[model samples]
Target chain A: MRQSRFGPKVAVAFSLALCWVLPIAAQVETEEWRFRPQLGLWFGPVTPVPGTHLTRILETSLGGGLFFRMNIPSNNLRFETGASYSYYTSPTIARLHSIPVYGALSYILPIHLPLTFQAKGGFGSNFLRNYPEGSRNWLPLGYLGFEASFPAGKVVNIGLRIDYYFVYEQHLRPPPNNPNYRLYNGHFLNFGLMVNFNLNR
Target chain B: MVKLRNILSFGALAVLGCTNELPLSDLLNNTMTLKLLGTYESNDPYGWLNLPVDDVITTSGVASSDPAIGGGSDLVNYVLNASTGLSVRPNDLKFYIDIAEIRIARGQGKAPGQPIPEYWSQFAISRQLLCSDYATAEPGRILQNCADQNGSSKLHEFFNGGFTYPAVDIEHGNYNHLGIYFRRFVTAPAVGFLGNGTFINATAPERTMVATFDNRSVYGMDVASLLQNNYGEAAAEPRMFPLQRKDLKLFVEAGHEPYVLEVRVFVKNNMMVHILQPAGGNAAVTYVAPIDWNTNHAYRDLFNGERQGGSLLMTARTYQPAKSGAIQFSAPATAGEYFGVTEAATMLTTPNMVLPLAATRGTNTRITNLPPGNYNVYRLCDKTRCSNASTPGGCDQAAGQDGYPETVAFCGQYTVSSGTTTNVPLALCSSACP
Candidate 1:
């Protein structure tokens, strides 16, 4: 089944309101409808980690994303979730360029002063142009990060961040050449910034 | 209970998704900078490929005596392969040479990025020599260095290939430095550099070798002191400000006012981001100015002149004549145009880096205005024209030096209301100047 953007189990806020007043309420809902679309970037080095010698990480990266944060009215804490599509490429020793598709998720905690902290994780896959086998590699599995969004305006959010990602393995078997070094497993230590939009507002 | 707990977690996650949702694809697309892959071989010292140039030479190794110098190979890997790439419509390439230094081949045994020893490096810094191990027809192979240097290392210098004007190519730095070269019609600095320099490639702090003294007010002009007195000026302060390269900021040192300082930035993506600052620490200095408004990459062109595998860098000054008997005025814009007398701002109409020539004050310097179009202008004081010039300058290439006499100053474009003549005062070259 195709995944619904809002997920499978969200009770409509109006339904929740009706449930509280209904003689026999069948739906379960608390009460809240909100959307804050924020655009921000993923700040991390391209390589799996800092010390890995074999794989040559291309460059540090940046991208934009949509952030929708729902808050319970009158509460300081907000339920946050988001997803973003980003692109990355690295040239193999054979001059092969591979592009990747990325996705992300997060939970946000907004403070009183234009600053918000978020914990985020995402997944992606690398696709090479012509390499038949080992062409598609899953993005390194685990990512744990924290980001602080600087609210530029009611609609715009600029962010500062620090993130770490872990690599599990390579998608392809080793290439025939000896000089080829693939980045299979490593840790990325990144300090970067981002800009995101508050969609619902 | 475990299954119920998992379901609850899933529900929590979905609820979170409702508000913070963003399309992953567009975010990446917006940040992805365009990169071009081509082999650039030059000895330009800065290995800067973006700034303005008068022309693009077709090939490298222009001659046999030329050194394995220009920008070092490391500079190329840094600017072209290392820095962030620029996102322009179409890309162009050039093999231009403005500075060349001859070096004793350190022996093929040396790998790329390996530093030449510090002591020997200075010998080459102050002087240019053939790879010491290589053979030379000139025997003693002594080369002419820039006139600024004073002592023994003097004979070791390389030739600067003076004034390669009407350069095979040129453009304006109206928007970005290379806009003068590649002609991006935009009127701002390159995008990828917007947030540069904040992060350093921790893997390597900048390499430190014996370069010219790093000063503040004088900028790197002190290298010229190798020619004059040691009245030493204070060091230029290091300022790391925001630029237009998209995601970076670099802290580079600079000089006094009136000199817009653009720095040559190299990233992993091989993009050229030029960061600018007004000549001095004038807090009021805010907007970026156009033309050689840079201070850092002065010696970059030297890398492209050598046989080294690095990118080349040339300052905005190459296309600009210095204050002299012939020309004492600065180019109208701080970011000088490419040899084509090109400006980054002018790219809006025609997307070409065609160079424009200069018109002097005296003599019926007639030029048939081609194509009935509006063109940004410039002027020259061809010293070779003055009869009183030291060599009675009349195209006596072997006997004459450069610049027009101060008496015959030439200026242009007094903002001529289009379809009109713009006469600028011209300076003639002086016999004392050289």
Candidate 2:
């Protein structure tokens, strides 16, 4: 597949976001009841299913996505939903992209410092872009993630997040008579940094 | 709080470092493998020989006129004066086998011995050079030989390996017969020289000719010229041959593992000869042999006799002791009226005129994943014409010229079992020529 021009650009943007937001986050105070909208970048390895002629040689790639979260009144849980896109690069010229739209319930851990750790779970639909024609277009997507966020300022914060995604489609399985018949699924991991805006603070 | 932080840390590490492995069972379960075995021969019926490269010289290197004729005439003598050094070697031949049709017979509303309707028309298989002499040779040499046999020094493989059909639907009734078709691979013509020449420049040069079995004057007519002018490109165009067999029986059962069909092809040597002697001692009479010594076989007779509607007869005054019984004679030394009778004769048993008795044999195995049941098989010569109404020219206009309205080559019934391999054997031999 042709090398995606989006990868390096995303990396440079993420690095710039981190450099600009970290020092400001260290000088900020904690905010409550704020809509924490996040712009993030992710880089990770992607392993394609064996025998998938389309993405047989894709092993790793870099991706990025934007997400938003809202803190519920008097609760440690945050409601989160976001959209993300990933690209798989391989020498077989198999161009593949994964786009997921998700909603999640994130629980904030009790901690003393300004940094907060959160665990999340979500469910959504992942639309595979640039896949081979006639294959399943969309798969049910499920995800689990963990993130650590620190206040950059009264309005801005810098955070790191790790998200694991699972996409599955019954139509992708082999025929019943074939010995290898099983559920067709993809497992992906995205880990990167996010810049958040405390909109209500 | 410390314990909860440790737990969260461990959970994050586990999710980020999860390992995913693909299932291997899907890769190996659906495909079947096939193996081929046997030997092949060229079986040139006309015994066309090959000339060594060293003996041949271009016409530009030789003088235009013959010194023996004394340069009195403008006719440049193109002579084929071969003496000894003649070798007979058949050129290697290779061809493809196309399994055009495969179906199982369903016994629905028909008698037990009746032919069944063809319900499956989705099977199409083609394997190249299944009958070759260099089946196990290197790829470079095999490709060169397949393209141009003249440049390769190694003997080509006539019978090679088998091929595999990864998937097939044999879920219905038993499949009993298979229809086999053979296609010729286009290659350069095999060429050879009859003899070396002694030009006035005191150099011996060789003349070249194609060693093809197609004799143009077989019916005392120039068929090649007629066909070329009338039919255009179809005169030398190659078409696939549908091989016919007498006894073929194969049975397949639904839900069986896989089945292997073994096919063996054989080509026989069918050369016949008849000699006619003189009626009286040295009378001034010319005799012509009957052309119908063999009903449909005349490849060799036309080659040795009158070539291109011209007589090869010669008149001689005196015969040299060494060349007394030779078929070809030199021009007489004295230019007076020679009263000897003109005789046209050829060594009927020369290697160039008679093909050596030989056979090419090969075995091919076809693997299919089909359900087991009792079924019958039949061979169709022309798939397009197999069902056409029989006319004066037979099905699809395939009769009349080449004897159409042909019967089924092989038909037999057998049963197939699921998960196990069934073997169906087919043997093909040449029909008698005379």
Candidate 3:
């Protein structure tokens, strides 16, 4: 991950570019409501528990959590935060799974059916189990993802997101069945499609 | 020599022009040119030129004087049979077995910038190698010999003749099992009920004669550990050398010079891959003897046969890649638990495939009748039965294969899409977008 020391610049550049191009989504006329539930997809790389065998194996990662965006009444910028539930299968960790809790800060890129990509990073944990001896694990995760939205009612919105996460942790697990050996580690990669009930647009 | 060199170079050169020619055949013949995506052999079109890094002999390598080829006792009157050291009821093998059915797919990994494809294809089949060398010289299993009564002529029907399932709901079918051929590891196999006579019913029973070898031969756990530690595990690509996780000249031996190795693999519509390390002692590569299907009235020996490794290695990477990274493991859990980082292995640990073996002509081994072309290779690992073949064995694709490690492993693909001198490095996998 040290190699990515320079990634922040490029990421920030792209984020800025999106920020300049998109205007804050016009406040949905849920005239009375102040909350917008967003349907979204969370994308990111997952770090299996250190010594996680399926850390790099191909995985089936699918997860989604609710997205809540609080509107800053006076400005175009809004505060966006959401917790996602993801289910992804690592090629090595064939059947077992990893779940993460994520929090994101977004710059609402504007358009009517607006599209926004969050430069979201958060802290989370992977509860790896079905193991002979269960172990507890959690790690810090950073995500650079994009979200696309389409038509919905005044306040309620539909969202789709693709996220790529950099799960910070070593990947390499001992053969779960026979812990005497080592297995591969597959990073967490997820594509989430969700329907959020927009409380505030 | 100079003239020959020029021909080789020119033969390799790609001509970039469209010309209106005489006849179509003549144009086609003149255009026997090719466009390849990988390295091609300048000397033999049938062989591939490796990515050599200077052939400066480092230490004048020591040759294995272990009879590199041809020298084994002629155990001609070979009665091929398999048996569990003890009579195992079908139920017993069930307790000791796990199965998987594989379906093959392909595609460019979904990355930031990759070609948006117009069409994609998926194949539902099992990846297992069934060495057809069941017949050598006379008095062999007539069925294994190409000339015998049940030889080559019968090969077609038996060789990947395309299996038929009793139901598409095969997800829960009995045919999904460790069948007569050990290579086919099916999911949810129905064992223990063989022709109404179960092994538990027998006073004292033994599965097959193969089981006798483990009892009779010198069991070597060190060898198994050495291989497991070194080779890691076998992915579906058998053309790979279990040692370096790359393709090196490899073969199975019977005796000094009398080596009969399985050099061919048959792909079938059956969606399962069974990697039985074979139930033998040396616990070595079991391409030595042909599988004995009739031993226990049930073609597939439940006790012996193939034992694969546990865990499957999928080709996906997300470790912030640097120009170069260390292959070592992380820290250890505690005492009694050995763990450390891995050194950079020969194979690339990246997700994109680096090598592929599409034909049986020349697999893993350096010598074979293969037409020259550009080829791609990669390092891949799949789930094998754990602790069921070797002292601590497990290698059944039916079981889940492990994930990729930090080591350098890769696969390749062919680019014969070019002109005449075809470059077809088939970097293939069991599934794509995985």
lDDT of each: 0.26, 0.34, 0.27
Local error of candidate 1 at residue A174 (angstroms) = 4.6
- For each candidate, what TM-score against the reference? 0.25, 0.32, 0.28
Model 1 steric clash total: 149
Interface RMSD after interface superposition, each candidate: 19.0, 11.5, 26.5
Tens digits of per-residue lDDT for model 1, B1-434: 99999998755443322222121211111111111111110111112224221011001311111122123222222233323322221122111111122111212223556654411111112111111111111334321322222211221111111111111011112222121122011111111111121212324322111112111011011111111111121223111111112111111111110111222211111222222211222111001112211111211122211111112222221111111112213323111111121222342122111122222122223222212233343332222211111121121221221111211211222232224443433232212221
* Candidate 3 docking classification: incorrect
Q: What C-alpha RMSD does candidate 2 show over the true interface residues after superposing them?
A: 11.5
Cα lDDT tens digits, model 2, B1-434, are: 99999998665433232222112212223222221212212211112223211111122322211212222111112221233212212132222222233222333223555433333222333233222232312233333333243212211222232233222222324333333333322111112212122232223222111111111101111111211111112322221223322223333323213334433332111110111111221111011111111122111222322211100010101111111121111221111101011111211120111211111111112222233444332221211111112321122332221111122222234444545444443322111110
TM-score of chain A for the candidates in order shown: 0.50, 0.68, 0.54
Candidate 3 segments exceeding 4 Å error: A1-58, A72-77, A89-93, A110-123, A130-134, A171-186, B1-434
Error of 2 at B73 (Å): 52
On the 0 to 100 scale, the lDDT of residue B52 in model 2 is 19
Error of 2 at B192 (Å): 32
Question: After aligning candidate 2 to the native by TM-score, how far in Å is the CA of B429 from where it should be?
Answer: 11
